[model samples]
Target: MDRQTRSLLAHADHPIAAPLDDDSVGRLLTRAVVRDDARVLDLGCGSAAWLIRALGQRPGVTAAGVDVSAEALERARRAAEEAGVDGRLTLHRGEAAAFEAPHPFEAVLSVGATHAFGGLLPTLDAALRHLAPGGTVLVGDAYWEREPSRWARETLGEYEDLAGTVEKVTAEGWTPVYAHLSTRHELDDYEWNWTGSLSRWALDHPEHPDSAEALRAAARHRDEWLHGYRESFGFVCMALRRTTDT
Candidate 1:
């Protein structure tokens, strides 16, 4: 959500710590309470990061990744095969905005893609649709500036609508498990580390012209977030644990 995070995710697998660190991600997987034989659905799963990580670290769980990008899906597939987790990790190319559950997943996760789906409304809708009762959904996105003077919308662009999105989720059946508002330094580390790896990988994959360009373009598109938010940028990630009690 911050400039640094945007940069890092743009360069996922960088030598440094991305805005979203591997340790934090691993901790998310560990805390998810995924039961034996539980099925996990990863929305916008680029390179199957969470899926592959879960398979390697946590056995007896099925991990499935869905994304709109065919190239991203292929990379995810390759990663699974290489990890020898292909049997348990299923990668699919599908629309993230209105993706349907192939089956009810025990856990649903969407990383930076939550912001891409027009803030929280569509994201929560998709996650709720796929989750079984008592399922979990992990989401990470940008937050507001610290103790803002003007409205977030006036200063921030698309992210201005995030607050309302958070409200809608609470009104829905999903209960917020964690809303981590990370500091600037944390976000900076994440973006740098994440995107650094991505840049290298993109350079290596000369076949993907668009992806390479996108990697380069990350700075241009996200320059504002990094600059403006750095003065007071924030990171927010919430894991919604769905319950029939809703």
Candidate 2:
């Protein structure tokens, strides 16, 4: 996508950038068993909603957010300032795998941005690499809700079944500690809010060079969801921790 479309998608009012609502955010945070002043990293953090919430809930905690979109990071900076956590947050603009820090974090998170690391299993590896020993890694990922036809499967690209997902994580030496599957309502909200934001942007920027393209892209995504894979897919935030010897 072009910078204009990316800017539109990263609009300040675009709701939660992760594929989750407020409730799921709370659950994922709780699963981390955060401690006061813990250091956290959010891969593909979008506009820092999760980090802001974490800072609010845990006094003195510090966070770092990495995303490739300058537009998204711009919004994130504003959000951190508005939340009074600007001083405690560091924002990086880059791919998640290339994000380097002074040290590993107590918790690492990625939501709906696993594609940056290529796919689900690769994302797991990337997140864990930056995780402190026994630290938590919270991943928001999707699985087939039901079997899909060949056409639908190809359209949605590749995904593991839930059982296979769990198995993959376990095989990677992480133990699943908490899991929250998104409801249909939450999923619908994420999809609609994203497209709705783009529509609003296109309407507001009718004279801009990219306006038509943005509008067309938004419409295409809406149609794809409604007619193609909406019913056959599901999302979850699974919290995992490195397995340690007893």
Candidate 3:
């Protein structure tokens, strides 16, 4: 993640930074191909909710999470302690692409944080580097729901259609296994959650210097989402497996 992303999220009080609905996380885990004591790495893992839940479920699994935000990492550490998995959960504060573990991970999940690697293909390439043989790679990202107007394209930047994304993943030597997509209703909820949470945070922290920035960010999210990009974009969680030895 970039400094701007960390800066924006630093002032916000949301547990999760992105609109990835909580329910979609379970679907991502189900899609992952796990083995006994699977080692997992969560790139740009905010608050470590996914990591804690995964460790709780597998019990035998150990996980690591990387995020550049100190505030987010603090929350993640607290969550791990509360979940009694802190002993097995390692949290690092740095660029996601710079994260290195003692060995390759059996499952690597980067949901809604591909920008950490700059783009889709770059993200996949970095993730593949850390994957064990037959490991799972899960990425949750937004795509064009329809051909956007030029204005919208300029605002949203480059994003592949669902079919194009799948094709590219397959071409990269990953076997597409399963996918979960966010519905229009879920997307609405996700966007609204950010606005609502950030607004309330700004209200409660009026004395904070960054409160105004938080409020402005909330407004920007709402404006861009409702007016500029609404109905034109969709989010998907695609899970793939390494087809060949890494």
> Which number leads on TM-score?
2
Q: Each model's TM-score, in the order given? A: 0.76, 0.93, 0.91
Show model 2 residue runs off by greater than 4 Å: 1-4, 7-12
Q: After aligning candidate 3 to the native by TM-score, how far in Å is the CA of 193 from where it should be?
A: 0.8
Candidate 3 residue-wise lDDT, 1-246, digit = tens: 344453445335435454565677766786683665899999989787778878887889999999887877887888799889999999999999988777899999888888889887888888888888878988878788888767778877788888987888889888878888788877787677768877877788899887788888789878988888887888888888877866
Candidate RMSDs in order: 5.1, 2.0, 2.5
Cα-based lDDT at residue 119, candidate 1: 65
The TM-score, computed over Cα atoms with residue i paired to residue i, of candidate 3 is: 0.91
User: Residue by residue across 19-44, what tens digits does model 1's lDDT show?
Assistant: 55666777777666368778998887
Best-first order by lDDT? 2, 3, 1
Q: Which stretches of candidate 1 lie over 4 Å from their true place?
A: 1-9, 12-18, 147-168, 194-226, 243-246
Residue 121 error for model 3, in Å?
Answer: 0.9
Better-scoring candidate (TM-score), 2 or 3: 2
In the range 1-246, model 2's lDDT, one tens digit per residue, is 576345446344545665677878887897884778789999988777888889888877899999887877887799788988899999998888888777989899987878788888889888877888778988888898888667678977678888887898888788889998888998888888878888888899899887788888889888988888888888878888878721
